[model samples]
Target: MIKNSYIPIPVKVDKIRFETEDKLIKTFDLVFMDKEEEKAFRYYPGQFAELSILGKGESPIGIASSPTESGFLRFTVMKVGVVTTALHNFDEGAIMGVRGPLGNWYPIEEMKGKNVVIVGGGFAFTTLRSLLIYMLDKKNRKNYGEITCIYGARTPGLLCYRDELKEWEKRKDMSLYQCIDWKFGAEGPIEEAAVEGWEPINLKEPSKTKIKKDIKKFTAFVPQLVSAVKPGAKDSYAIVCGPPIMIKFTIPVLTELGFPPERIINSLENRMKCGIGKCGRCNIGPKYVCKDGPVFSLKELEKLPKEY
Candidate 1:
């Protein structure tokens, strides 16, 4: 609903919490500075905001929390660049600048009655988390068929939202699968035995309690992950987010599993300046990655040049 490009609304930080042990990922719970701003602002799943750290400059980050919870907004930021690193240093109750919750959202209506398959790798899972929660909201839950989530990271400790993932796994309406490319050897037998039902046969649990971080070795097992999330021959959709290489291989696997091009959704990563359509940095051919999408159907993706 935030349609204008120039409006700069001041939002006070309600909380800045670390959701992951890795210093890279943090969640900021924010509310509008003037209570009225909250009344006017709303966004759909997969839309994004332009967050400015005052003098440090602005960056576009996805609205990582679902729109179902209305009082506050959240952004799950990974500390990758200068502005983000500075953002990591901020504490609770700080003020930051926020602009449009811009761009077209995922086609939730179109997805009704269709099984949802979500595949996320590394930090890319942040935006996918928003879509997952949106679908899980009470009214929306029944609109879709079975929900399947396939999430992976470089290592066990590197995985974000461990507690949330555990809870999601318990839901009767959803099937959740998580994998770490390498083991850190921290959990040992207990953790190993627990995940056997979800992992592939060739990648069995190790006898030792400690594990190593080896993402390269895990690349071979990606096909198996794809298999676990593949829907039946009909009535399903797949949404994927992750590093470029993971996405590159996963799409082919989904196509082989018979998911049509129009049913496959993906969020692209590119250098974005404006959260709205104004910035040119994130353009892939004629499309603006920020406004036209962070989310795109496979049919639309096929039309774009492979510059992203």
Candidate 2:
């Protein structure tokens, strides 16, 4: 829905929130400079846009806000490089530029009436948050069946949207599974395992006990958590976004749970650049991650060159 692929639309950073205790990740809430651009710049979960700053270059970031949230766009960024660090230094009301709503989205329509499993790790949870919020919206909730979300980070402090994660855990419509790295497990000191409102489960136990309905926190890698959750594959689809290693391992767990390749989805945002297909940086075989994807089913990715 972008009016021009080459030009970045003017926007203002209305608010900025640091997402992690390390202060390396920040979520920018942007408001389009013009009301018309605000309305015209429609986007969905899993799509990304290029954020621009004069002389600093552009960075393609996933849209973290759901469409159900109007009048603004949210991008959760990690301050890893020049552009992102500049963004982190910026304060509220800082004017900037945005260049999309580009790339395909999660199979929202196809997911209608099917149980949805969302798996994510670390900072990759941004767009997954978008998809979850969109599906959980009242208007869209009826179209989807049960929703299950399994998310993990190295520590509780590294998790994004901490407040929202707590709220989601209380929601009856969806099941929320949170995990920290194994170092935070019961084997660790009692003080470390006692994160407020979290209960650690011993990984040596059966998968059933590891994922009991009342137990939401686990000390394991994202893939191990997915296997423990063991969500049903009947009329279900699993959407996963994470580090490459997490995806590599999680795919097998989903397949073992009976989810076909087509039913296992992923987002390749780490490979995205330019936000339009003109730049070849995102190419994997004949497909452009910025154009053809950033979103793809395992079946589709299997056909690609695996360069990603």
Candidate 3:
């Protein structure tokens, strides 16, 4: 673990895997240069880190690999700006910096014995993947009740961790519901309702209407897919991570299904930067997204300013 929040620990890129077909998003696996740092680096799911590149700046990304998976840490990054683009250009074995294991984590202890409903969309599924893998481990599996996941992307190619998603689908221990915004056929992309800008007339009920038939893939927006699956809210906690629009729409569906405000949790990764409270970039009212949380119960968030 890092003793000083400002000093970044040295690490080397062990592996890189492209997640999206656009060649923009990639997952980097890193290992600490010092064996002691590796031993000291203790973290739980939902915490984030600042990946630093000398002379290029740093980017805050959530820790995608769970603690159960040892030896390395994983971060899925989209090459959007200067720092990310530079990191993407570097080859394997390149050295970098990781400044954290910072911020609060998902309520792992609180979630024990309760059913878990994970709802994620687009690239925001990184930390959720960590939480899921942590819970699915043999030692942790019996500690939680039923596990259900609802994940969707704009298209099949946009989804991250495709191979693990496939393996997740095959597991009898949990239920996975995957969807894509539109299904492509010889004609082209089908289903306008699944598109990002399209809003349903009724937020609680997603429109099932489609522009075309004979599309093979499950086609629906993340919120719409949540409504269709309709996981029971009794004795359960709902964790949501996605674009702001998706989270805005999903909360109502989960609430309509009987999840109380406190039972609904959200991860505000977009609000984070610097991975520490010093920057003040991640503050909403008196609380800091970097320090107070990247994870918060819906009830907790409601108590804060509406800035988020």
Candidate 4:
């Protein structure tokens, strides 16, 4: 019986980056305090850790960088509660605590030789970012077939990793498709609809506010853009991470294009009071999400209770 499971290893927050305009989600780059511990760290994408902030308790957040990324571990967090809010408020160099690389990761090995399509929205793009980086690395890029990424946010300001997305768009190895919910004002779909007299024409953009031209090009829902990509399902895998509703709608789109349940994966997260899965409440059936998964194939997930 290991008695020290509750103790957290000390780490120093080396850098802080605010990826979204609202500043609700921030990515913290951390390194272990002990050099040896840093050297020994290992994790895969879609795994998570229990992050501690002393008085604020701890929360489970996904590890956002590929193991190929060295030196530091990165966690992209949203300030949704006490611990996360405290995390966002913490400064660079602040000492913190991390428990593990808990939960399963994406099936990288199984995905080899298969074309891949990644679908993500808002901050849920963290692990997808890791998967993309790993697959796109020059050493590994050849193992896969065609690569396509379809990502979106409510608006340009809501997108994470903006600069990286720009660079990704320019990369010849993978196809990048980024979209906004709706363009706003005169040049937007809403205005286009309004001028056409609002008689049930589809809006290309979701909001009524104006935005820049660079953002206007992606003025479509993620599902819509995904359909437009038409990635073949026969020899491909689709990994999706997004809001529950976004996920619900996106699955059907993938299926419509021939992707099967076994080839579609979801990186899931739940309210975890204990990272070790000892509390038992994160159960979707016999499985404890914290310990058994944070990643599951659509087929595997279907076998579990829909209560999730």
> Each prediction's Cα RMSD?
5.9, 3.0, 4.5, 5.1
- lDDT tens digits by residue: candidate 3, 1-308: 54677888999999998999879999999999999999888999999999999899888899999999999999999999999999999899999999888889999999999999999999899999999999999999999999999898877888899999889978888888777765443245444444443232223445433322222135677887787677899999999999999999899989999999999999996445566787777888888888888899999999988897
- RMSD (Cα, Å) of model 1: 5.9
**TM-score ranking of the models:** 2, 3, 4, 1
Which one wins by lDDT: 2 or 4? 2
lDDT of 4 by residue, 1-308 (tens): 57376778899999999988878889899988998776656787778889988888989888888888887888999889889988988999999998887888998899999999999988999889999988988888999999989898866778888899889978877888777764433354333332221121234423233433233235566776676556678899999999998899889989888889999999887788787889988889998889888898999998999877
For candidate 1, the 10 contiguous residues with the lowest summed lDDT are 207-216
Off by over 4 Å in 3: 1-3, 185-189, 192-217, 270-273
Candidates 1 and 3 compared by lDDT, better number: 3
Task: Judging by lDDT against the true structure, name the best candidate.
Answer: 2
Off by over 4 Å in 2: 1-3, 182-210, 270-272
Q: What is the lDDT of residue 31 in candidate 2?
A: 93
**Global lDDT scores for all candidate models:** 0.76, 0.87, 0.85, 0.81
The alpha-carbon deviation from the true structure for residue 160 of candidate 3, after best TM-score superposition, in angstroms, is 0.6
Q: Which pairs clash in model 1?
A: 183-211, 183-212, 184-211, 185-209, 185-210, 185-211, 188-209
Of the two candidates 3 and 4, the one with more favorable lDDT, higher being better, is 3
Residues 61-136, model 1: lDDT tens digits: 8888888988888898888887888888888888888887777788899999988888888877877888999999
Pairs with backbone N, CA or C atoms under 3 Å apart (clashes), candidate 4 = 181-206, 182-205, 182-206, 183-205
The TM-scores of all predictions, comma-separated, are 0.86, 0.93, 0.90, 0.89
